[model samples]
Target: MKKEPIIIGIESSCDDTGVSIIKNRNILSNIILHQEIHKKYGGVVPELASRLHDVNITKAVNKAIFSAKIRRHEIDAVAFTLGPGLIGPLLVGASFAKSFSIGLGVPLLTVNHVQAHILSHFIQDANLNKDYCPKFPFLGLIVSGGHTQIIKVNDFFKMKILGSTLDDSVGEAFDKIARMLGFYYPGGPMIEYFSQNGNNKKFTFSKPTVSGLDFSFSGFKSDVLQFIKNESRKDSFFIKKNLSDICASIQKIISEILLDKVKKAILKTGIFRIALSGGVSANHEIRRAFMALSKGNKKYEVFILKKKYTTDNGAMIAIVGSLKYKRNLFDSVHVSPYSKFKTF
Candidate 1:
């Protein structure tokens, strides 16, 4: 039998430090260490995130290797998220990955953060529903704290941005709106949880009209703020009394806005295969809406990542790494990290 190649993936692109080990198409272990220091600040502190990555990268890698029961020498290649993130955090992971790969005498793979999120759909896991694996030439919807885009994915590395936010990503909008509603930091989950019990129709917010597939959440975010401010003046307890409903309404509007563009993209591309990725994909409301869009439609198929890979993680990076490895794509040791890099 041919030996399966082992790959190590490291991701410290932002607030979380992650390490994962994958052998062939199967993941052996994935370890993530989230930075809690930024919670008190209501968002990620770049410098603090970098410091935490420095502290945890080694530990995270060790834990992943230990959990996988694999020797460091067994890894054939090292992959790390290369760009489109905070420079500090990116440098931390990039520096560590380059040094480690050189020390191991293995080739290094650089992964684009956004591309990894979309490619994460291909990561094989025994626990995931096979129906969630999307085929090639699909429509990819990436929603996260830092990015929101509708992409046409033709192949492993061939992705074209059909539409992207002009300002304020979907996850950022969710967090900011949740903050206005008296929620704590990292409010996406809180908003999602509370939205379940609330009536989505109880409150209605204006949606922005953007031409084509491109999105503009800044205007919508402003509308949300203004609506809450005006309503709170009429009744000081308005937010408290309608917290659930407000959350539901917010989620409903956001989902609609996102899906509207997706609907347009589908119309434009004539591709029925749809895939959802990134942190915001964890929103149950959005996921349900996407699933509903595909249900009973013989021409439509929808795929979503497992909740674990929705956020910043090493597994996604490793999956991309494995794909690149097959193509003999490797990065030079002199490569550097960047806060912003195009996915294409």
Candidate 2:
């Protein structure tokens, strides 16, 4: 077998500062250093994220390279997140990657942060042959706090977003609902934990009305707010007592909404392979519902990224960059960070 090139990935698009070293499909080392400052703000503060990235990037890169047991000169290319993130943070990561690439005289591949999330599936379950991960022209669903969309992966570096959220992404919905229920700042997990004992049927919310394979979570979020307001009039502690059931129901509705879009994409495209990524994909109900649907079809294969890889991290960035760099895919150093979504 031919030896694969070593690709170093740097991710500072968000709160976590990540560094990963990938050699072909194999990950030698992935180091992530998180910032706890955002916990007080109930979410990521852009300015703080940028500052921390500047501080952590150096430590993360050194640690990752050291852990991988590879010399800096041995690295074949440098990979970094380019856009769809906080500008300052993205710049920090991008600048570092560009400088490193230039210094090493190796190629630098700038990766789309969201696309990297989907590609995360490629690195997480490396044990699985590429076949199980899905081939080109498959459907991909990316659901996170900041994004939600279904894209067609025509090829590794070629893609087209088929559908996206009109308002809030699924992850954002989860966070909003969690907060309204008196959950903490980052309450997605709390909602999930409390949802275990709740009855999904107790509360019925409207599913988003999206015609063209897209998604809309703002309406559902509105419904959640109305439901809480109406219930609170009856008893201030109603949610506290019925938190589990409410969470279960809310989670179920959101999962179904997302699955509906994926179903539409698959039916329209005639592609059976599907992948689920992003922070919200970590939800157990979403994973189970998606798995059940995929299992029913002989032509369908499903892949859900691991919890660690689902969140913003350099591993996904590194993996995507490695694949793209090997194919001679390099973005201009002038590529700037984009605050909104971008289609491939």
Candidate 3:
């Protein structure tokens, strides 16, 4: 028997309010409304983000459903992001999902925002999704703007966090570094683009050694700051002429540091299958590094998510939710959103 295929996914976990429709493996419509309103602030303003999500969630969802040429009642299941995000934003999305599910008389599935990322591979990677997929009990590195974690995924619902950042996550550092280099607010991509022509050997950046497989990026961030300050003492245009090289060098160092720790975690956990998900994982340098780490190593088959799926989105949550629904896993309508709901 074929499963009832329509699932509506709502993502308001952060500044981006996304809605997507997934009928099994194919994506029918995915609409993302990203707020660049916080550009001047240099970081996401929680209140502003929540407000934007509230305003955009319905519009995005309507667009998704309409573009897919489907009615609300056609949606068999409703899926939503539950935690590890701004409470106001998550609540806006979560409550809407629950209410909509009730009105449509469909089952409700609650998806962990992080796990949605891994499940993203199930949608983005055709080889993994339709053909050769990883078996149970894998390792996943979940890196994003706000969170960084190395998790041991024993199953779909059960996993353990082996390591995480004590301070800033990798993507946050990228944005900060971009700002220090005098780029736009969301300077990560600009930094990566400029980094192409620069010399990584021009500067020496130190890697932070966290206890065990856990990580720390705060010290490395300070090192970058002090390095920039010291270089400015020699020349006013120190960052101007050397900006590309500085960005390149810093990006390379950061990528290497991440891969190194991930390798260590792989060995310690003895997990053969490893997957990466998050905004930072979209970085080409980091992706290349992860690919290099997985090559010819039969003990580990590394999973890489498509760049489009790496950032926060609704399809991932919907996919996770659909799978859980098939297993009779559902969340109550009485659930409320959480700001700091930590679970591995």
Candidate topping lDDT: 1
**10 residues in a row with least lDDT, candidate 1:** 125-134
**RMSD versus native structure for model 2:** 1.9
Candidate 1's displacement at residue 4, Å, is 1.7
Tell me, by TM-score, which candidate is best.
Answer: 1
In model 3, how many backbone clashes occur? 0
lDDT per model, in order? 0.90, 0.85, 0.82
Instruction: Predict model 1's lDDT versus the native.
Output: 0.90
Residue-level lDDT tens digits of model 3 in 1-344 = 98667888888888999898888767788788999998889878889998888788889988999998998878898999888788888988987898899989888888778888877767734232234555678888888888788888888778888888888888888888788888877878888889888887888889887778778888999999999999899898999989888988898898888888888887797777888888888887887777777675756688877677888987787778777877888889987777774674
Model 2: CA > 4 A from native: 124-131
Deviating ranges (above 4 Å) for candidate 1? 126-128
Supply candidate 2's per-residue lDDT for 171.
Answer: 79
Worst 10 residues of 2 by lDDT: 124-133
> What RMSD does each model have against the real structure?
1.2, 1.9, 1.9
State each candidate's clash count. 0, 3, 0
Model 2 lDDT tens row, 150-245: 989888878898888888778788888888988876788888898888898898999877799888888989999998999999998998788789
